[model samples]
Target: MLGLSAFLESGRGDKLSSPVKQFIQNLLKANMEGPYGSEWPAEEKVKRREMVAPEARYVFVRIASLGEFLTTSEREKTAASCVEERGPIVGFVHFRFVIEEELPVLYVYELQLEPRVQGKGLGKFLMQLIELIACKNHMGAVVLTVQKANSAAMNFYLYKMRYVTSTISPSRVDPLIGIEKSYEILCKTFSNEAKAILEEPLELVHSV
Candidate 1:
């Protein structure tokens, strides 16, 4: 069975081959069509390729064949060798390390899974892996933006994963004022310093 350890990581400035880029594009188009496409125009959706090309780094989960797995050292020999030959990518998570509200965080730009792979606990495992990466890198939190129209994602993050709407997030600051936004920012904090920044009421923080 394919496991989390089998997934391959891609980082900044890594030139993804055409097949890999296509794999990512297909997943993004399929997953974001419902809410994001509705909110943004068709042209904007098409333009996402250009936008996503530069900033995104990825963890790619590809299909593994029975009794054909290679050791991690062997897999690193080639860029795409770790991925299955002529097989569809199972899923990918795009993220970057950045500073938000003056705190360092691992910011998840996108997470997409094929319909066939949904509900197999892979998503949760990927999230746990990212959180571990964040802690190891001394990041204060893990953060992501979710479209308000995507109730499934909202429920998954807020209810199942215990992520909270960040204190400085527009919606958390003032729902009425922030309702103009199409997305909500959420975070899972790992440090007391980060929790203090993200969990306190904005008014209280300002008053102090």
Candidate 2:
């Protein structure tokens, strides 16, 4: 993946400052509220709780002026200067490493981007970095939830990124229930067991 050249900065959720936290909330609301619709209130509550989890991890994309690069490497290069130099937080991915159906996985909880940055290839770059992280940690797979209503995001993951709707996704397990659900679980597996458990449909898993 042609990445950020170290422009992407990562940190723990617990270390996020008040201003950074506020940026996340505003960005999430701006980027996701529409797809969630009336479920936004409940989903927002869930998001708030998840964002502060002690183990949660983040990849923050800071504001780089039109022709300038913003990061510790390019800026003053001190911990404090990195924070003070980068203009603002414009995008971020919140994720965690956790056990899912007995398999260790990297779960992406949120991927939010500012509207102005939407078509600039940053989203795909971030996902590639996330997948690389999963592989480095020997995670069996990288998993995420995508709203059915968010067609752009759905396309980006399912088609562009080659992620599949996981077998555990509501629709895959039970079509009837899936019809009523708003989101789908998607995964990219690195092992056969994970492929069977997460990528194969429930019926196929039962037969095998």
Candidate 3:
């Protein structure tokens, strides 16, 4: 991995260049195509539209190569510049701040890393950072959707990150309906109200 120098930046989806959009589409296909199988073609049609929605924000992770001869100051500048223009992009997180069950939350639409970086704690670092942002911004919780077919991802969020399945998730609201669905909604709550509404296994009922 050449001791990856990963730098991140946040911006709206519309601001992404064509190359970066292609990178995201390719990465998503590589990671999810197998899990989605026959449904992949249809799913990708929807993703293409969602990935560029004006309201969505993104965090891009780009890799910068460092030369040993470069001074510390030079390396830092090179990295920051490469992140904006020349570096290879390795991963991204697409998110939005929205109302979930009447409480404001940061909804993670996608969090993807190249296969080479999968087991290196980068995913955890990103989620922790996202959760911190949500807390700092006074959001109630951090929410995300995970595919049931991707058991590795489900386990990662549930056990490693300690995110509970939200009450609004289909399974928690109604098992019959949830059984036919392919994904689960997960959340990490920050307040008593959020905890009760999102963490508990309750049906889909709005609070007064």
Candidate 4:
């Protein structure tokens, strides 16, 4: 069942509620520890907390009785009390609309699903919904960063979703220079303006 209608949107003003933060932390630990633990354990902990901070917007998947999804907006709401008795949250997507390199974009910070829900097309469904949101808001593109060690995510974004490596991605800018970073930037452009801006050579754009 699970259609696009079963998602709720919430905005965290200056801090994440305890319950929401805990949910994110648990998901992050389950999803990222394997890829990031060996190299920078402490850093991963810091990053996980930072990712779910006040500034991020969230979309939570809710299951309905009839097997269809429901969509709700809590833009004016605050605190975890709103979610106290909303049943189990199957998964969530954290993102923000921001301007990157002067180009407007929808940047996805995290897309974590319960282990039992993985590989059921829910991830792809959520991403498609995000793209729709971006387009409606006039964002030129959608972008996200993936850890190099997370092969599954990399494959999902690149091969399955057809996202391309951003021209500004460290590796794309300069392979040798980018080796120091452990992540790759990926993007999907929606307009010619976005393509021109994001696909331009970084060196050329920087010089201009």
Candidate 5:
């Protein structure tokens, strides 16, 4: 296995590592099949690559604002970028920076992975990196939105990353029909050691 430090170091250029770029492309291709029962246009995938860098390889989600309602954007200026391991570009995340309760927070704007790497635990690895981001920035937690039906993602956050399920709601894109829920808010430190005790992995006991 590659060390996290080595994987983190692999990120450069567009904040994407070589491994991450390949992952994002695969994700786009697989999901390019589109939504429930609908066909995702192939040309659209081409357009997505054009919008984001062709070689992007990391997955960092962000938030943004446009018109009256909030929206998602990926173009980076001075804030953050996601880089993977293989090279400089493959997959990437788009996000907006904001404050919550007077603490710096990242509102996961958007995320994507390469098709070939979706089920190989990349998401979990990326999320742990977010914890480092929170600690480095002196923030309380990282927040993101997931569609209610994305059960696989829900399990990753609730189980692997130790995030709590908060509330269930709908999204703007067909908000009335489908629901979007927020999950996984990590506190600066464990609020309750007892809870932490039960949650802590046996292997990590030595680290503590």
Candidate 6:
């Protein structure tokens, strides 16, 4: 289990361990820094908090351990359905949010798939599910950061659901590795649709 140690290890519990945290830390750093420079301690800590808050309603996908899965985290369980094929847990999606603008900005915090189930359209399905949750929550919009280099994922965010691009600053700790290293932000809005729907509601109801 050379590469699978983190995924296979027991006692993962609710929060990510230091090593797991470090792995995510470095992964995000590389993604942000373009395999070039390093991040400072303060910057690293801020990144870690943003990614793996223990209180955040994180999601995990697994193939086994159905009975006791919900008890393994600090956050409250929202949706915990299984994806079965021929009958077993093949994948799952976890979602949560941080408050923004007095509304919950839905975050598709974690998505995972077993190697055996990777190629199917499950990812797209899960994303749509998250989007519906965002709509239901009446969020100002949904936000998630993706590496600029990941074209496949960027396409999914951009074309599939119509996420618009924006940018954020590069803190001193993790200086922008290059132009592409700027944080990529995406959002969706409902104000236009809301105005249209609200205006027609009384007229439509009366006509009906």
Per-residue lDDT over 82-110 for candidate 3, one digit per residue giving the tens place of the 0 to 100 score: 25565767788999899988999999999
lDDT of each: 0.73, 0.83, 0.83, 0.75, 0.43, 0.48
- The residue-by-residue lDDT of candidate 4 on 6-88, one tens digit each, is 45656563466667667777777778888775766786667676665667778876543213222233211221213555545
Error of 4 at 91 (Å): 1.3
Task: Estimate, for each residue in 1-208, the C-alpha lDDT of model 5 and write its tens digit.
Answer: 1211113332332655454455455555555444312334654555355434534223432222112221243223111233323322323454434564444555453455543235555566666666666557655456565433456666666677766532222232234443332323322232243223323443564475
Q: Taking the tens digit of each residue's C-alpha lDDT, what string does model 1 give over 95-194?
A: 8888988999999988888755566677788889899999999999999989888898999999888899898778778879789888898999999999
Query: Could you tell me every candidate's TM-score relative to the true structure?
Result: 0.78, 0.86, 0.84, 0.79, 0.46, 0.49
The 10-residue segment with the lowest total lDDT in model 1 = 73-82
Residue pairs in clash, model 1: none
Task: Tell me, by TM-score, which candidate is best.
Answer: 2
Candidate order by TM-score, highest to lowest?
A: 2, 3, 4, 1, 6, 5
Candidate 6 lDDT tens digits, 1-208: 1111111122222465554444445444544444223434556567556566554554333333333323455112212222223223334444566664444567554454543344455566667767777788786556676555666667877897677652221221234543546346555655654323222233553586
User: Model 4: residues >4 Å from true position, as ranges?
Assistant: 1-7, 13-15, 64-84, 201-208
> Which pairs of residues collide in model 4?
5-69, 5-70, 5-71, 6-69, 6-70
lDDT value, residue 162 of candidate 1: 88
Off by over 4 Å in 5: 1-29, 32-88, 101-103, 167-208
Model 2 misplaced stretches (Cα beyond 4 Å): 1-6, 67-83, 201-208
lDDT digits (tens) for residues 50-116 of candidate 2: 9988899999887555234345464443233225466556678999999999999999999987665
RMSD of each: 6.6, 5.3, 6.1, 7.0, 14.4, 12.6
State, as a TM-score between 0 and 1, how close model 3 is to the true structure: 0.84
List candidate 3 stretches off by more than 4 Å: 65-85, 201-208
